[model samples]
Target: MNKPECSRLYKVATKHVCALLLCFCLSLSGLYRVSAQDIELKNPSLETKVLSSMLPDGWKRFEQSPDVQPGACGITQSPYAGNTYIGMMASPDWSERIVQELVTPLQANKTYTVSFKLAYPPEYFSSSVCSGSFAIYGANELTEKGEILWKSPAIMHQDWKPYTAVFSTTKAYKYFITGPYMDTICHNAYRAVLLDDFSPYMREVPQIIVQARNSCKGEQTGSATVRVKAGQPPYRYRWEPGNFSDSIVKNLEKGTYKVTVTGANGAAATTFVAIGENELTADVTSSAPICHGDTNGIIKLNISGGVSPYAFSIDGGVSYQDEPLFEHLKAGNYDIEVKDGFNCILNVNNFTITEPEPMEITAANASAVSCSSVKNGSVELLVTGGVSPYIYEISGQSRGYDNVVSGLDAGDYIYRVYDQHNCYVEGETVINKEWRDCAVFMPNAFSPNGDGMNDIFRAKVHDAVTEFRMAVYGRWGQLIFESRNPNVGWDGTERGSGLPAGSYLWVVTYTDSKLQEIQQKGTLVLVR
Candidate 1:
């Protein structure tokens, strides 16, 4: 061999031997630090050091060049947490990474949380846009890649940003990596990721928890409590069936209730609670059927469970009342509702009212001879309502169902009917004897210009008159006023229009008590 070639080979061998010796020493140091450290991963903050390279002591680089820097990296800014941080180059086809094995393996079917500080320095511009992310892998041995248990979306920012990833695993995870996601960063052509203060710990995800507050037996204050546990605070709660924001809801019905609690960090959880039959109810009692023509019907309501100071509604939805007693109601059906302090409504649809058995008595005419003398009279009564076999008394004369009194002196007579149910009805009949001859008197004049008195042309009738009628005609016989009723009069108007002051002729006809027909004619004057 030539002397120059031998010298070059000797130099190459010495360089490799020194490199191997340095790697061996760093490995031993990392092992000792890991055994003595409290953190699951040795040198978790990247505090350990090795000379001749930009790598930390306990971390391994992956497939590409990555560097650790104290102040800046290619115009990038300083570290976020410690004295030194790692920087990696990312592109479409390749990305640099730093990976480590945890001292304690995460249990299967368990949750964990990881946090890290990251930034894309504004002074360092590669593609004008950069993004990076982190992930956890479930593996028995540390590898470049494995089954991913959790991952975070790629984030791009110029200033230091804090990010957290919460995830669950079905397999024990002993390895974790932080860098750019190759598939996403490649689209932007190239990106530089600055990572510092990488931290991983076993932490449970936010969970929505529900607790029950059962109401006392036969009460409606049954409630459910909603909460978020083991998650970030400042939680927001929403309930089903309504938009209630409180942590506890009262006066619940017998059903399932759901609540969603959202954490401040956008984590959410849902839980459910159930209520049973220990709620409020309304009991209504109705009175017996009120007899027709009575005003004493009643309905009373009783409520149990729930809070007090209840309100009521009976008109379907028209109004609400605080009283529970309903009185003077007609015989029919009604729907009732009761509400407690919690605004829960108990609806009763079967309230009923009915009429009592009927009982009635009617008395007919008493006889009289004249308008000013004593006379013999008769009273007849018709009995209705209640059971059959009724008894009646008239003017102190008692008899059976067909009650009749033929020998009654002139006066007022009282008649009463008693039914089988012992219910009674009373009535009065007068045998008048001082009646006068039938006649109708007409008014001579009237002033109907909005006057308070004497504004109508009306006629007065005497006693013993069966029927009377009066009609007024104009001077030209135009038939301006007509009436079949004696009490009905005319205002000095023709067809609802005021007539000129003038004299009008009237004719009155009537049937008298003696069955005689009388007719009279007269002139009535209108003042205005």
Candidate 2:
């Protein structure tokens, strides 16, 4: 309760506080000393000396404290008398040594900054003391084996203040040395130079953090979020399944997806998220087949009942995210497989494709014509057999000439017919009689003179000619006349036109009255 007691208690508390403070300072000092030792210095000293002379062995001196100009009062006396000072003196000419000590062992592709403190004594030079310079060396010989990393012309004043000159190490040097290369042209003789707090050049590597997700929702309401540490802001974020935007993924499908993040500083990071499933069924469809050659028709398959965005594949091929429609398919069996929103694939049953058949050519009789003679004969052919709307080929030839022919011809020939399916049948009969001259044969020849004689070339035997084609060529092998009807023919003229004075070859071939190719060839002389 007395003043003396209160004062004694306060003193005791002060003593304890002082002891704790002392202990804290000692601990901090020990840590600082350890950290300083790790900074390998070439010239570790706390004395004022020319940086060139302080350099270790193999180092050449560049410059020292050489006198510049004389003056009564200089910057050496007042504000600049602290730990930092600047002076104008010739460099130790040891530019080589400086470089060797500071730039010989730096790594490639690394970024680093150089830093050091400088001060100028106002008493050493006139108030006009303007600037100073320094150099670095990596080799003792200082040949072209090193480079200049930094230079400065710091404005000098009458203050002992700290200044820093920064530089970066190049890939050519693995180690380096640094010191002052002075050019002090002062008007005072008391100029002083001091340097301290020189930081060892070092590079800082950038840090990256990448994140990813496994799956996401598959419907309109489904979504996934991805985050990454890509350095600075204004980062570019992009999603694989959609356009690039500043968005956490939304309404995703059941499948794998990727997200890329790029920062403004050219740094990049990536993340992934997968959407959930929502569907189960798939729909398949195909165009109607027209013929065996209609293989390029579109075949489409749409999936549903499982997920929104589904994966698709055909016959175990590479999987694609978009709905697929195949083209250029042949007439055969096919299988299409589709994956649901849950990454589940369902293989469809085998489906067959059939194309329509072409027209067919058949014969009503098996009869042959004699050689080198005109015969008054009738032939029959059936074209309405096999697949409906069929195309046929009819051919016939003599016994010796096994090359079956089509159309009507004056010769002994056998007949053969083919249907739309490329299937054929043969029929034959022997003729023992010879014909006379210029015989007007039925369904064999027609004179298209336009005088009501034979205006049309046609096969008019009796039975229906299913598939037939008649063509007439000029003497120059050019098709001058053609007729598909059995009642049409070429007369003495070229397609009812006046004939020139020349010999033209005429050929008639078909399955005449018989279901075989009857080929006939003859020369018709035209008189003007």
Winning model by TM-score: 1
Q: Show where candidate 1 strays beyond 4 Å.
A: 1-39, 51-84, 108-110, 121-172, 182-188, 200-528
| Best model number under lDDT | 1
lDDT of 2 by residue, 243-362 (tens): 647546655555666776655543345556555454456667776444445565556886666545666666664656466676667666777777655455567767655454433444
Kindly give the stretch of ten consecutive residues in candidate 2 with the minimal lDDT sum: 64-73
Instruction: List residue ranges in candidate 2 displaced over 4 A.
Output: 1-38, 42-61, 64-82, 86-113, 117-135, 140-175, 179-196, 200-313, 316-328, 331-393, 396-528
Residue 325 lDDT in model 2? 76
Error of 1 at 191 (Å): 2.8
* Candidate 2 local distance difference test against the native: 0.45
Task: Give the total clashing residue pairs for model 1.
Answer: 10
**lDDT of model 2 at position 488:** 62
